[model samples]
Target: MTMSTKRPFTKDIILLDNVEEVTNKIIQKLQQDVLHNLKRLGAVVGTSGGIDSSVCLALTAKAFGPEKVLGIIMPEKDSNQDSEMLAKELAATFKVRTIKEDITSALAGFRCYERRDDAVRRVFPEYDPMTYKMKIGIKQTGLSNNLPPVFSLTIIDNKGNQEDKILPVKEYLAIVAASNFKQRSRMSMLYFHAEALHYAVVGTPNKHEQEQGFFVKYGDGGADVMPIGNLYKTQVYQLAKYLGVPKGIIERTPTTDTYSAEQTQEEFFFQLPYGLMDIYWYGFENGYSAEEVAGVMEESTDQVKALFSNFERKKRTTDYLRMSPVRDYYGS
Candidate 1:
């Protein structure tokens, strides 16, 4: 098999020039958002051993000396052990102050797993929570997949066996509620440190996740400043390389890091890989026809249109997540 080269459509989105200049602008923005807007001494970033957070942390450290930034590792029982270790490793390399807050017990009061499991048992009666992990996903219909994805639940047994079944609406709601607690819990921890140190909480989402509504509202979505939110995932990687982020982090795959069953961002939300998805979103935003983009990306027109349709579907479904809580007409 032969490897594919960069596609022409990348010109519409990927920023290939003046990476240093762009990096400087983001650095200034982070400083301005924290020191000026929030009047905070520094910024607090929850590092997940992923490139987005790693790059965000590096930028924050550069903006306000490494001593000022705080890196918090908030892992729970389902969190990957390597994530915590890598987060610490990134902190040490950047010379940023670090702290660990295991939130498994704190989230216990929420009955996260129990409620989720209760719903799971409705289908898989013999599913043992202790010995297995569960993940929810959508069934991809076809290239021209105009219809909404059929959501399904998947369970992985300890012996590495796997099972997939259609998810009831109640089960989907329960699982999502339980998983979201993890993000909200981490956000709470970050605020605790930020409040204590008079620092701003820095969000790590890239343009794709930010614009596509991929983040959980009032959870990972809550932040004083999103340092990398304006950059596409590919551009974020460009900065990552330019900023000398840890090689391990720069190369690690982007994951939801939300579920115990191990799922990628593409699997959970975006159907395409971040690199490809970024350009597609850009193309869609700029009003490029799917057939036009398909020709450049070497994909079938139907596939490109399908992805575009899916993007629109997600945006509509998640629009509510982007809103502030409702109040009285007087803005109470």
Candidate 2:
């Protein structure tokens, strides 16, 4: 796994040469962690019709029998219709049992939409939930620029007329706190099924999500075992293909799907496309110099360095998300 400075640094550097082996290793670890460690009868996965969840569901089915795996499709009012469709398709493909739990009512009860919209209206006085869709995304800070990321709020009216504004910190925090309810609600549903069925909840976060802190701490981040946590986004796609995931899902662009207005994972959080980000991240993690990466990426050295710096900043800031509860004093 030595990185050669003289040799070309291509995307191939991250490609898994032994896809089958990698898949089997994950299946084995999952079985061990769930059946032995967690003492669970089977595995429960929250499927979003996305690549990560699809691959997780497939691995769960393979690790335990298909009958032992339960795919819970949790959708809310803001969720994409295609997410449910693809999630169902994924379960069917693997012969895993699935149950749909629409959390729209639950979210309403929790005032999820109302609270989020209330914050949106603070920024856009004319915002009306009935007539408008809203989303928040990070403004591109230019990976090479070493600038703090800024978030922008967007409201789209019925006619697709759109307005954008810089999100004040207060509104941004309020909006995020409210939107997180969707994930927290979905997590509650997954745990209920897991407990009832005596199955362990399997997480679907990839290396980027886990390391870069793109996931909600106790929401999507709550799981007994994470099989793909170590694999990069590109590697997850590799596993999806190896596992025969549906073409539609494999080809689907990654999205936030948490917002009503359409937004991509890139625009919402990760600034660059997964392909470029993956390579740069790999270089950064493996101690590759900026000049070396720049030579390979054909970008300026300072630009590569800035991207690396950004990665470091994200990890540092999100480190708290990955920590266990602080317990300084135990009874002696």
Candidate 3:
């Protein structure tokens, strides 16, 4: 809750001063959570070569030793090649065993592409899955605007020609439902490895994803332990550096990597860059006034207030993603 005096209310407000101390505490807790609490002998992590997963892999290696950790690199047809390359680098760097599972065929069996494309074709009749790569992104309305978020579907042809359309609700829901199979399938694969080896699954969602409902339920959201669930994205990068994660991965832009066409996490869901989002989120959560945050961020007070409102709306609407299954009993 303390802010650095050097620049009060600035981005420095969220900087982790004692990164080593913070990381060591996480390591200690992860050991206790997995070994003692879950009665697991080892850890299973699905590495995406992203900062969150890389950090989780490193922490698991430290907690259970490299020999006791298994990193599963699950890639589908739409995944970036860089994701696989970086994941392998991370495993080699951490000295952990890794298994590569290509889920493209599995997704094929589930008709993931078929179902998703069926919806896309409704919007663009000429859309051909084989000739076009597609992605969904929130229209950038600037975080300071009070307008509701709008989602658009974009398809890029082989020639790099792009076309975008305002996604209809029915098509949007159908597309999302199909895309969720990817996460849920990955979760199943992770649990399979975990159960087979008597290892607990370590989830990689950071605070933003976990809190803002940016994850799939029982999918990426399912895990025995989420070591960095409490850490902000900025803090996750801090741990990444202290833990010696690969520099290429450290510098790589955070992405969803769920679509065939490349898309960043910011464009897909979060509208602001992580650094600015982290600062605003910290200020909002800590009860700092919009006027104070605006002064530091160099934005109008109304804009800051609007961003805060948007944050509240997002949390309220996505609260279901953070819930336990309801079990109300009338008899009781």
Candidate 4:
């Protein structure tokens, strides 16, 4: 049987090149919305070290004073120094009140009786919480007489740890399990913090993720508000400049930090360059049919035709995910 594509669950996205003017306007509105709600409700943002969350934090703090915004960094035992460092830097630079919690202890507390090797399991395993990537280090196997390029980049899963690999939902049960555990941990962590301080749980997902149902249902997906939801990958970068977020944060690859600090979310999920996918989303969302979109961004005639074929092949799942649910039995 042919492989089945994952259905889209979010709104239909229309592609519009150079959407900066309109998108920026929406972002300003979102910024104001976040500001109005948080200050009035005594809400703070639970920030992670990732770009999306960091960007949201910057926007939120700008709207509300740094004193009013609370940022939290939740890193597990497997978290890297880069992730924690970024978190600490954000707190210091922005003067946002911060709480640091390492979730390894929480994991241990939950699995009080498990053997060291047996390891603990989580309820929500669909969400992998760590980002892992392979460092292109020392590729010279036998080059004593000649010099060679010192570094290159290639895909490595979960940085160096096998335990944190981001897995597809249809694939391995363990990765899916771990993803669920970490994802819920993140959601609950943010929500609990949100409630205690009267802050909103800010969502940090992207359009591609939103379209593909990449988030856990009601777990990571549930949020009080989203400051960065409407902004696509490129648009966020542009806004990041306007917000004064650190260049490092802006430069870092986009990843969930769910499996390991090295893995990127886009690389793990689509295994395709994010630039390509961004264009894909742009085309679909901007009212172009799959055929028409292929014409614009397709690299060559063969590529365009291939895209056409794929679009026709994936039409069902594509349409399903693009269009809003046709049948909703309950309104509430």
Candidate 5:
């Protein structure tokens, strides 16, 4: 019953100290693994015109050749065309086949689930959409132990101090819900493509997010093998440049573009830029205590500890990352 005090970020944080070498190693290894693991395999990538996907596309194309890599771009109705454009550009740049799938139809279906009839049934059902929707707009802050100081990150770096301005949390969640659904839908498409081609779904999430457990369960984190899961954001940029990722894709502030993410990805993490974050988080990922990690980074002690303590949440993310259907266990 005792609460565990270990900082979560240290447990599974992928080290990116030697990013160029790490990325090359991961990409080469995965390519070889997939080549040997499955027959007639062709890799599939979901390209959102984001930095992560661009890097993945470039590397996958290089390793497997353009004919063997497919890029799928999933755009929600509200999403800007820029994302789609970037995905297509990267696909062309890498000479990969491109598919565009709009997810507005699916979101409508997921939202339209009816709760018809019986009052008792309407009142309670374990799998009700209403119940799941209730997960939205609730006072569920601090649910995860990671305590990433997301607010502090925002307020600290935002020059105008606009981070404290009241944000529509409910609306934000709804928007994110729709956007995440689009991601999951696109991922489903990616997996199906992989299945047809007998190839692996190449994962693009990097090391820092893995440590912070920053992904939806059975969602974005799932992949056959994460080619860039070992790289840090700081390092990913360099590799992107090395691999010839377009300047626009590399320079555009990192964002899920979920819920109109005006703030860059770093801003959401309390304005802690990746370069600055990597310096200390690198330590945490390498088993340095929060105090020790913070000490070198010159960040406040409590905030840094909060980031480290997110171990349980990180563990859950790792579960999702490692989880998949067991073909052997199913007696195929």
Candidate 6:
């Protein structure tokens, strides 16, 4: 039997015909996968007060009773206050057992912010580590010119002034290495709870983040099971509505929530907005021509081509983040 690459498309974008059915399937499969396959008691999800985690928690609670699902809030110094508040609100609304594990101290112990600040200070001499929210992202200006995005620092001061500057290779690596500590720290906290309760760690990355390599390798991506891994950003919203996730969370804009400054997911990783990016990714993956996708996206052909190239490049570079541990001997 041959597989069909043809998918339901609207302007070259794939569409989900039935969201409720999709929700039911994911919940049922998650329950089965945990009980029969992993023999886990329930799920431990890091609730970030975002749609993805909120929806994932709701689905997990539905799979295993509310008592079995655990929602953890791992806030750091850089985390947005609204995100923490929303996380608490969602947990209370869902009636799930919740705990707070502040990773700020752990992050500090790891010199995560310290080293990242050192890198940023190199670029902005007057940068004060105490009053600044620093994040590193790919340089965006020249991507359309066929230049690969370079890792750079984005600093937001106490007054909300913003600065964007390219970092030296060594400084970029240092900043990223330190910043990754936040994700790893959060993962560690999640595992601490999951292991204590005999539950599986649930991941919240949607298809866009998962496929486009927007995750932090074994950090946010290191879940035992990903309930929404197959769902598009739009489809996740559908399920979110069906699952009765908190309205505020459902309506909130997608953000990295990893940085102190309020940074959007588009600014952090995906250059395009999730809605547009999702369709373009689906179109390109299904072998749709760049011109056709461009027409649908209402973008220039060159812009579409550039977006497609960036997607492929990121997917290729981040493939290692998705790989299983390497072995010298091949497995049968």
Query: Per-residue lDDT tens digits of candidate 6, residues 1-332?
Result: 99977654565245567878888899899989998899999989999999999999999998998999999999988888888889989888889988889999999899888888877788888888778777767677644767777777888889989888878888888777888999898999999999999999999888888887878888998899999998888888888888888889988989887766677887877777778777888877878788877776678999888878877887898898888888868765
Prediction 6 TM-score vs. true: 0.93
Estimated TM-score for each candidate: 0.93, 0.97, 0.96, 0.67, 0.69, 0.93
Candidate 3 lDDT, tens digit per residue, 91-160?
9999999999999999999999999999999999999989999999998774768777989999999999
Top lDDT: which candidate number? 3
Better by lDDT, candidate 5 or 2: 2
Give the per-residue Cα lDDT of candidate 6 at 109: 96
lDDT of model 5, residue 113 = 18
Q: For residues 1-332, what per-residue lDDT tens digits would candidate 4 score against the true structure?
A: 89856343223233334545654555566556655744444345556676777777776666566777778787776566787788778777777888887777665565421321122123223323333232212233212222221322233345443333222233334334444565567678877877787766777676656655556555566676766676666666766666677878888887656543355664445434566666665555554454555556544545544443433333434444345446778795
lDDT of each: 0.84, 0.92, 0.93, 0.56, 0.63, 0.84
Encode model 5's per-residue lDDT on 134-160: one tens digit a residue: 211112233233432222111222232
- Over 4 Å off, model 5: 1-23, 112-179, 261-263, 267-271, 289-295, 300-303, 310-332
Cα error, candidate 1, residue 73 (Å): 0.1
Per-candidate clashes, comma-separated: 0, 0, 0, 41, 7, 0
Name the better of 4 and 5 by lDDT: 5
lDDT of model number 2: 0.92
Instruction: Tell me the spans in candidate 4 whose CA falls farther than 4 Å from its real position.
Output: 1-40, 110-171, 289-292, 301-332
Query: Where is model 6 more than 4 Å wrong at Cα?
Result: 1-9, 330-332
The candidate, 2 or 6, that scores higher on TM-score is: 2
Which tens-of-lDDT digit does each residue in 113-219 have in candidate 1? 77778888887987888998988876765225777766789999999999999888888888888788888988999999999999999988887777778888888
Off by over 4 Å in 1: 1-13
